[model samples]
Target: MTTPILLFLDINGVIDVEDTDVQGENLPQEYSTVYPVPGTKEFLQVIDSCSWIHPVWISTWGKQSQAWNKWAKTRCWPWAYPLDSDERHQALDLIGHGSDKYLAARWYSRDWQHRIVWIEDGFWLSSLYDSSMGAAVKWAENNSNVKLIDTAPTVK
Candidate 1:
């Protein structure tokens, strides 16, 4: 049987929107905190119950991956994988004046390309909209993944 397809998650706008300074610019620090977005925990619970959903973090903040892992531990969010150094570099390299969606997309697993589903706040959607990987990216153009949720009370 084939392994489950990976679901790539973005932290800041997708999970939580905390203040962060990236290259002297203020941006969402999506990975440094443990608190989930409004319905994030519940959404994750559903993903956890599903055997086919392999959730993974795909954020620009490499420095916060460990912190995020620790946070995930409390919720048992199954954040086990870390992006490779090359992938990390690719993400960091995109930190510029504009959105980094395309740059982030480039860091996706080429081997498991279609498996990725980005959950970000549309920061870089337009730049990546026409890319071959656009459909894989989800969420509102101006909202965080967490904000897009309508709580289900519990994962069913």
Candidate 2:
């Protein structure tokens, strides 16, 4: 069997952002006003076509991921896959105070042997503020198995 790729997706910039650098701790509340990035449907379609890839939400939405899932469904996005509830809860438990996206992605995926693709827009921004985020950027720079799709926040 082919090794399934883990696609860790961030909603703020990679998907929900259009031309604004929307950042806040309001979480699922902030997500309510987000504008879907153009071509997001096509992106979802691509992931859907690739049966060997498993996509999981790694956004700041956090505990409200189910809300995001429901929103995606409303958009008719091919994003029906939900991360295992037990796994997600366990990973969140282990994740410390800071926004260590990479660390969370690692724990969420459960196996580094499989390729990981982190679709995010705040690597540079996050690096400037969060030390863990900075470390994650540095680590992704050297890890061949972990690929970072650093989408620009200004993506229109």
Pick the lDDT winner: 2
For model 1, name the residue pairs that clash. 12-30, 13-144, 14-145
Model 2 residue 109 CA deviation in Å? 2.5
Estimated TM-score for each candidate: 0.47, 0.65
Candidate 1's C-alpha lDDT?
0.46
For all candidates, what are the clash counts? 3, 0
Tens digits of lDDT, candidate 2, 105-144:
6675555477888888867777777776776677678877
Off by over 4 Å in 1: 1-3, 18-35, 72-104, 123-156
- Local lDDT at 57 for model 1: 62
lDDT of 1 at 37: 56
lDDT values, one for every candidate: 0.46, 0.63
Candidate 1: Cα lDDT at 80: 22
Question: RMSD in angstroms, all models?
Answer: 10.4, 6.6
Query: Residue 85 of candidate 2: its Cα lDDT?
Result: 69
